[model samples]
Target: MSKIIDTAHVFFFVVGLEVRQEFAHGALRDTSRARLAVIAGVASVALPALVYVLVVGAAGAEGIEGWGAVVGTDTAFMLGALAIVGPRLSGQLRVFLLTLTVVDDFLAVSIIGIFYSEEIRIVPLLVALACLLALWLLGRSRQWSAAPYVLIVLGLWLATLSSGVHASLAGMIAGLLIPAYPTRRHKVVAARQLFRDFWQSPSASSARAVGRGLSRGVSVNERLHEYLRLPTALLAVPIFALANAGVDLRGGLLVDSLGSPVTWGVVAGLVLGKLLGIGLATLLAVRLGAGRLPEGVGMGSVFGGAALSGIGFTVSLLIIGLAFGTTSDLGRQATLGVFVAMVLACVLGWAIFKVAARRWGEETADLPMTLEPPVDPEVDHIRGPEDAQLTLVEFVDFECPFCAHATGSWEDLHERFGDDLRYVVRHLPHHPHGPIAARAAEAAANQGMFWPWLDFVFTRQHALERDNLVDYAVELGLDVETFTEDLDSAEVAKRVERDAASAADSGAHATPTFFVEGCRLLGSYDARTLTAMLESSRRGTRTQEIPA
Candidate 1:
């Protein structure tokens, strides 16, 4: 009974990342890719489960049907496998596997809530729904206190527990309700204004106001995700694993299970089922024009990725607990089978990945995972000390929301590192408004006001029209006539062309591709990483570089 409570705590923390940054990942956007994910994810579960069914039916197994255990793909174990494989794996393989796993985890949680319930309690379920509604309302409110929400979550958790719905489902439910929009423009501007006030006053009262203002800039979802992340990953997950993963394998149970249908089902299903299901689904998707393989993810890489997807532990354990009595002879045999299958899956997947990756001409180990023509100091725009030890480069597109977000990281870097870091910005000009904004910045650069113009663009990216760009020039005290002329000047156009060409060549196809110490930083990063990267550069640390 307490196991459900603790597992919910751990699993919710794992899945709640969706409300903050998880939705922002590239694979989540396309309807085609999302459909592909659903297919692959469902197949990954269903195929394994089919083997369980077939073996149980054929052997006339009694008192247990533990198909649910084989359906889970353990995210933690899969990530551990990736770490063991080193960072030389292609980006496409990582993204596809991650998407598949996340989708399947959600699906499994939904199944648990729907299929694994005890006697239903209508009143408690309604009460839980009401509490969730309150959570939703509070999440949308401009003014909020963590205490109220915490109390409500307690209410919701208790109600969910009483209602016979899996308590862990509450986490996923709450996550689905949390708003995922970016930090809004007006809110950011207001935070800056509040900071401006506090900066001038330098008092405890004003500092409180500034802090509240700054807090308002982040979504409730993002803050909660960060706050709950540490204990969830380090404490809750390990505790749940410790409580469940122990198996008494000192006798004939192991040998008996080797002939048991349950044992063979788990081993064969997770290994062979996942490989064929994920690979064939992907191949079928491409043939049906549903989705294409991500770049650098060949057929062989898909084979490797699917093999890695067989690592199922946490959720599988949860399903086993739900399926049968732990002390029953059948359940004990099932547990032994699970342990044996887990080991086999890991070893088999690793072996398949090595062979498949080798066949694809991918380096198996120790390759410098970085793009060629490494980031150099020679760029279009430069700020900070010319002799700084590290060069921080960004491929900027003013119209891109991510580039606007990148400004926060850049400002934090400049303020903290000062003379130790040289900040370089170059244009990608990929969007409709990008060329105009780039030209405007260049014109401002002629007046030694480039940074100011860029700061304006970062804050007001949606307003980067021709008239607005000109208005920004006036605000910055630049000569309107000269600025207007420079927007179309041959030299400015050539500069934009040169930077665009250089950025394209450097694998900066995406906006805000950052290079720290000549090594590209992929995915999302925060201010702390920026500081650490600068420190690492100063210390001449050999940073891990993967092919971009």
Candidate 2:
């Protein structure tokens, strides 16, 4: 009973992510790509239902049909398989696989809501909808903090749980409604606008003396790539794994259910069906000219990815909970299948991928070439002292809200350590407002006002328009004559271009990518994690300095 409840809760959490990623990913503006993405998402839900029907048909009416209709593979099981494959596939192949899996998940969850659900309590669902509406309004108004979102999301989840809907739906609905990172953008805009106003105003003194005291007021996608990559890489997915992976063997009946037909069906579906489905689909797509083959991924690697797809731990557990009710023999059988399939798939996939990758030649993506348009005067020669004790390399987009947050974090670190840290900020302008912002940062750097401008941007990060960048430079007491000229200078453009290429080379698929010393720092780190890494680095430096 407890396990069923736990599994349901985990399912709800993932559903929330699915919803958020679906709606927010492209729904606001409603582009053709966005519409297609949603359609693809909705269509994918059939995989689980088909599996359920097949199993039930095989069992006949005498066998149990379970409670809720859902029957799906586990997410933890799939990811565990991928982990075993290691870096055998090229980055592109890995990304493609990740996305397809997410789409498959989206489909499975939709099946749960549309087919398996027993009741429709409109009031609670409406109430949940209202909460999301309120959050959306706040986010649009540029209230970009994650605090209120966190609190309200909890309430909504509980409400959904009590309202007879799956609680994970709460997560999906709420995540979509909450803004990704708004506060930082609001700050950037406010800061740049303030600086702009100061710049245009007539200066009674030299440009150096003009408005140095100005204060700050405030602050997707190539979806296929991120869609495939983020779900597994993100913390939310991992959290789901930890929560859903536990299966207590203390119960005797569950242990005995391994002999059941339902158990065999689920295990076979994941271990066999996933491999066939994914591998067949991929091969067909390539053969029919729907998609090209990714580099360095051999037939063996493809098979490995397919094999790992059978590790259906998280999603399969959810289906089991919905299908078998609590503490039943069927549920126990399903659980066993999930555990065994995941382990077997992971081990087998890893061996195959490793062997194939070794045979195929280790070629990487041409990241630098694909990142940005070419330029005459390359800025790749801006090298820092190689012998520095500590290096903090950051890839930022001046217009990015997270970049503003990162800028503040960088400043705090610099203030704390002073000369002990050598900070290098690189440009990574992504779509729309990105290039404009990069130009602004580069212009500021030319006049030695880069730090000040960066502080203002972080303080108020949203107003990074092309015009705003120039105006902010003028407001920062930079010589307008020099700054304006430099803004259009080939050198400035080249610098940003070089930064973009370097960011690509460093394995940065998104903005705010950070490297401390040499190792890549994964995900969003708070101050404490950064401090810990820094402290650890210091200890290492001391050890090296000792003549060992």
Candidate 3:
């Protein structure tokens, strides 16, 4: 039963990891905040260990072995609790906590591998290393098929198990090696071409070909994550809980655990230690110019989140089993401590958020919802009639494949609404050449050719380097010398910056985010869905104007 639980936990953990997306969206996007998060995460773990050592004076190996139980934050439970009881708008705060927890999980797993593994077996270790190399080679080959990767990862897990290293480590290592990349425009185009062929022929062979093309367009990491996320969350985790969480408290064990130093040490380490460690670290980091809080997430909100971070349920339980045998008295005591800490953490977090809301008025936890610096015809790049009743504003990046694909959606809306709709595009430079491409568009706007420049660049998203921009200028019939000079001009740069600043202020983080009549559109932005939403909004406007 234990071995089965361990295997399932490892498999789900690997499937749940979205390494590239997590770093790109959470940490790398905000370096200073990520640094602060790392510091806070370290402090959150380190301070608890220190607390345990202090509480359990003359720390014996047995007493110290339990330190790993305090190192991880249960990401699923913590996030769910926040959604239910946290501030109403918690998007940015959620991102911040997620970044911190990623570092927390990494450290916990590393500690398990370093401190808890049994005697090393060299032969099996070599086999594990070879399996890892094979997985790496498969990733580098850019193969979309999932079977080879799955088989290699299974071999890796088996080898690691035989090597006396925790097989869970194999899952983490294999997940990290899997290649992840942005959806390429060329691949998307190729997939669409395949679909067109299927549409014309309509046979099983053609249908299978379309399926293969569609799968090939997406990376294996993304495909696996998408398909595995639900099962990992709803099925595997619950099974793990059932197998590991049953504790027999009938033999005076509950009463004995209440007085145990190990029990109190685990509780104190999580509840009090996480609060002070994370809260103080964040304050010190900001004071030392390390990083500011996510916009609208005040210091008080950080404290609340810090309190919630103490709910280290899953990983803590896993570590407890690793540190002490399942039948040990100390294991039961540690489990009791975890339950206590969870309850205490929840109460503390709720109290903090309630106090912060009433006392500090720091209620909001996400970026602002309304459009900042509302669209102005004189300054914004507007299409269709300036006085059109319906307005669609898009924050776009030229180098973003999604934004390029959204060109069809934009055109569809334009064709449908024609004179009744106005479309505005704003710069949100998220890719490598995003800023430069935006600047080129602005320079074209200087010569009254913004729309044409936009059309040309969106179609050529695969190439947006400096040379490409220059070529686009020549193709658009602009004076090459003037266009080139304007491309680097401070005025053009400022124009793009203005749009970017507006995007940030309006809570647009990703490319191709849209707003309809000043309200940020949520969910899918396909043409059909957007059309329905627009019509609904238009009717609502008419109803309001009828003088209710």
TM-score list, all predictions: 0.78, 0.57, 0.84
User: Rank by TM-score, descending?
Assistant: 3, 1, 2
- The candidate, 1 or 2, that scores higher on lDDT is 1
> Using lDDT as the measure, which candidate wins?
3
Best by TM-score: 3
lDDT of 1 by residue, 415-504 (tens): 888887888888889779999999888988888888878877688877889999999888888999999999989989888888877665
**Pairing residues by index, what is the TM-score of model 1?**
0.78
Q: By TM-score, is 1 or 2 better?
A: 1
- lDDT of candidate model 2 versus the reference: 0.55
Report the error of model 2 at residue 282, Å. Answer: 5.8
Instruction: Return the lDDT, model 3, position 170.
Output: 63
Best of the two (1, 3) by lDDT: 3
Candidate 1 achieves a global lDDT of 0.71
Cα RMSD to the true fold for all candidates: 5.2, 10.4, 4.9
lDDT of 3 by residue, 1-548 (tens): 45543554355345335644555343345777768878888888888777776665554425667888887777766776787678887877777786677677767777877887567899999999999899889988888988898788778777877787655556666776777776676788888999999999999999998998898888888787777776665765566556666677879999988888888888888888888888999999999998877776888989999999989877788788878965789888988888889889989999999999999997877777779989999999998999998988999999887772345898788778898898899999988999999999999999999998888788888898899899988888999999999999999999999999999899888877888888777656778877877887778841111100
The 0-to-1 C-alpha lDDT of every candidate, in the order given, reads 0.71, 0.55, 0.79
Q: Give candidate 1 misplaced runs (Cα > 4 Å).
A: 24-27, 86-99, 113-118, 140-148, 196-204, 292-302, 361-390, 399-423, 429-432, 439-463, 467-513, 522-539, 542-548
lDDT of 1 at 539: 88
